[model samples]
Target: MERDVVCLVDGNKHLYDRGAYLWTLRPSIVNRIRRDYPKARNQDFICFEHLLPYQVEMIQSMMRSDEKQIDKLNRKLTRTMEDQEYRVTDVNETLKETQTFGQKIADRVAEIAGSWGFIIFYIIVLVGWIVINGLHVFGITFDPYPFILLNLFLSCIAALQAPVIMMSQNRAAYRDRMSSENDYHINLKTEEELRILHAKMDHLMQHQFDHNLEIQAMIFEILSEIRITQKK
Candidate 1:
């Protein structure tokens, strides 16, 4: 079997870009067994059961790293983060998400401005402004006649505000796009790890089955030889 894989993190594993699997084992313990009982030194059993002391130490280091990561993550709110890469990607993703939200709000404002309802509301307000000013009721008419100027003024305000809002939204959209790309990559890696795990499991199981079959065949052969000897 091709044993090609890349990157294993805190019980999470990935095989290229085709699969991912997340699992956990006490590396500190298992690694220790592998190290302290190196198969080469103790050749009485299968190699899988023996371990080197160095291997155990490596597991201890890995455990320490995992613990530190978990502690860091517990203090934050993120999709998947507890390390440098995860943190960088998460920050980028957050920036993107925030930008996306801002753009959506800006889009809503633009839509409201373009709607007939908004226009009608402004018209009514303008009429009331005219009445109040012409009749001098509350004497609060700031801009009297030439309601066209009022329209012009409002238009100018929109012209300036719209671009500013849109500009802000545009910047945010760009950030979001970058973050989404990173997320996609990470997710892709995760998928790859999953596929890799299934493949590994299948291979391991098949190996076990074949091994059992071999043992059974050996037993049968021994029994057959015994019967022949008895018959003789």
Candidate 2:
């Protein structure tokens, strides 16, 4: 006949098949046992009746830890979403709001100067000037051939138009830079949010798997009890 094992907690004899050695228990369960029985050793035995409370405590502790972790992730995600709401803005509207009067004029001048209407109007003016001066139209001989006054006027307009066009172009470049920076910041935040979400998903999946195993173990224990009661 096999010898009965003595339980460490209750000091009662139990069949070897109905108890587990301390070393065979989960680390968390063993640690809980050691808290009460400071001198507990690996060779000590524990019956399922005494071991059930420690197993329940271990499962509860794991569930609480999972809840805390999930809550932390939720808080972090909420803060990220709140920050995004305030950080995003329309770049065009912001630029327009800050634009100086001179900058508006420059932009307007550049817009008109770049149009086909301006080109056609400019050609008509040039042809009129050349015809009037070269042909001495209506006895207006103030500007003779190679129109010196017209040349001077053209030079002055070129100097002024070039600087105005340059100013408009510089502002356009600044707007583009601001837009690109905004896009970069948005992309970075999106990436951070995605990473956090991914981490949360992985954590939930891992904990879910662990919980499923624990639940399966509890179901089997329940089934075993039901079978024993039926046999009795």
Candidate 3:
């Protein structure tokens, strides 16, 4: 009859069953334990107890590494968020902050020209001018039948107002672009935070599963010891 084999780790000896103990463990788990206990080279003759401190430490080390990586990402994202907040990225605020004398004048002019009040008032002035000139009530016609001077005045106003509106529009477009970029950065940070949360959760769940398995193994060991004692 073959006697049961025994294994040594950390100066403690335990039963070694190839079929029940050795084969049941994962290769990575075995490798990590072997790495920690360098003297345990002959694993076939060596056995490890359930819930080893070294195995727990290995899991904690892995969790620490994951936490460190998440912290690094958090720091980077925080800096980016701070930078974005510090700068004036708001479209209206940026336009107001960077407004030059000429830009302010252009924006004001565009605002007035774009209003319904300005349109209605200009229409009234045009009609009054045409009526006054057509009736010749004052017996003096400043802009005659063809209204050549009126045409020139309107053309000049159009040329000047077009450039001003275009300048204001350009500034608005630049402000909008800056706001869009800031929004993208905010969204990216949010996504990174969510990813970190998911990774941490996965790590914790895996650690818990391993711990539960170790606890079950320890229970089995206690049950085996009780059975042997009862027989003796």
Candidate 4:
């Protein structure tokens, strides 16, 4: 029996760091992360939690394949990926349908910036005005006369900032949608490869069964020949 292992492949530093932190904490899961965060530099794909089965299989495959053969295979796969029919199908749509996770943080951040954060800031500003008028907060009030002017300013700022904050949320949602699509495509491709593997396995099993049956028939014919010779 062979054990499963995980490896990570990331193009973004922050995402890579996230993966490293998680894998280091629990050295059991091994998966590859593919990310292209423009802001994150110096972070590349990393292999993690190497297990026995994967190592053995890798070694076996490598031993069976020379560099030239491997290159040929890779090229073939790449060409297949570039086929017109495959290209026509939208990969993003498939990824959107299937993803590993939900973009909760993106949603929450957008939500806060759009609504809750504004509400809280507004409350704080209103309190500050009340304190100034009533000489509250240890008698260190700055704007002493109810501060109608400041109140007007705060309201104006809130009105403007609210829309801007809402824009940020909308942007986040777009990014979330894109990320979801990426994850879905990865899964879709994985399942496709699994199907190919399954087909190969089935063919191998059928071939072995047929070979065994042929061997059984051969043995029976040999025994019959022996018996006939003894009867003679």
Candidate 5:
């Protein structure tokens, strides 16, 4: 069997199957190689591996002209981004719905305990206890002058209230941590959206640049034709 054969711009020979090549028939590729490699100025073929500086950039520019090309950079970038999955979540709503009965009670207890209304009510109860005992209103005294029984009750109230308040505080800390995490998620999503927007902007700028170059080329061709007509 005979193998395919090819010649490079550098006057080198190789089996066609072993090397990738572009034809000089493409004026853009030929011009790009000529601009970069003076030795390949009039060559009829260019080897992929031996492409000189700016040659790859030229090929990329040509590839961008055709959107249907599978290896197009913009298509690959957008496709990869589209394939990624992200879920938008509301952490606050989720946390609220997942709260346990104990959590609700703890929060309510903490709110009431930390308020001025509860403070005033507590003071009134203490004052009433002392006045009733001092006046002997019921013709009996449960807590005498020193009010030792009242003191015990006060101690018991403090012992029980402290832990309840702490439980509420712990829940608040947990809420703060969750809020922070939610903020992080929001920031991350915003960053990703900005990146996608930036990518789109870059693609648009590249497309506009290519369009302008094509228009310039067309204008040059038109001017050359006009000059030739005028000379005749």
Candidate 6:
């Protein structure tokens, strides 16, 4: 028992239930109708045949907006990756490239001095020196039991070796600091990329849901038209 109304655009009679009132439509659709029919009123009715065009336009607009947002996110991610690329480097290779001849020598000396081979060799030399001097072997009793000359030699070796080892250790600390900074930069960049990806995913999901709802509305409208035709 639905009443009939004239379509605003085509002036054709249609069931009131098969059309939409201007006031109940979305603002975008209302504006589109107003553009075509400048004298259109909030209470005017439009048949589904004319309404379909505006609904399609709205869906296309949403799709375009989603594309623009995705493009913007892609550009942002590219810039972020480019900016972080220069900050990460191999600390070991960089240190090696900048090392001085003296630093190389110091590192070599420290390496040799820290080994068990060096310890054993040093003990053997010391024992040999003591036995040869104390026993006066081969009539070599030049510096008898006190061994002042041997003590001076040991002191000089200690002084030189200490500074060399310290120099190598300082370089090692510098290398560690540079390595830590590089790791931090890499981690920061990864975190930012992940955050941007999450935002992009959320945006896509929200828009996809909106699109699904719009499509579902279109399906319902089509079903209503089919039922109205069958009843006739």
Whichever of 1 and 3 has more TM-score, that candidate is 3
Worst lDDT run of 10 residues, candidate 6, spans: 223-232
Candidate 1 structure quality by residue, lDDT tens digits, 86-198:
32356555654666565666667767777899899988987787787777778676666666667787799778777956766676677678777777777765765556555
Question: Per-residue lDDT tens digits of candidate 2, residues 1-232?
Answer: 4688899997998777666899987777899999999889999998777877877787788778888998999999888878855366689999999999999999999999999999999899989999988988887877888889988998998999999999999999999998998888788789879988998999888886787688678657645744553552
lDDT of 5 by residue, 1-232 (tens): 3554444555665444333344423467566665656555352444434543334465456556644433355665565455434344576787689899988898898899999999999999999898889989878888888899999999998998899899889978887888787677667766776776676667657765675676566456445544543552
lDDT of 3 by residue, 34-136 (tens): 6756554434444334334544565566557666865766676566556544443466776678789998898889999999999999999888788778889
TM-score of 3: 0.60
RMSD of each: 18.8, 3.0, 5.6, 29.3, 11.1, 2.7
What does the lDDT read for residue 55 in candidate 4?
31
Looking at model 5, the pairs that clash are none
Highest TM-score against the true fold, candidate: 6
- Positional deviation of residue 181's Cα in model 1 after best superposition, in angstroms: 0.9
Over 55-143, each residue of candidate 6 has an lDDT whose tens digit, in order, gives 77876777788789899999988988899464989888899999999999999999999999999999999888888999988878766
For all predicted structures, in order, the TM-scores are 0.42, 0.83, 0.60, 0.40, 0.61, 0.86
**Candidate 4 residue-wise lDDT, 163-194, digit = tens:** 65665566557667766766666666656656
Backbone clashes for every candidate come to 19, 0, 2, 5, 0, 0
Better of 5 and 6 by TM-score: 6
Kindly provide the TM-score of model 5 when superposed on the true structure, using C-alpha atoms.
Answer: 0.61
Error of 6 at 149 (Å): 1.5
In model 2, what is the error at residue 134, expressed in angstroms? Answer: 2.4
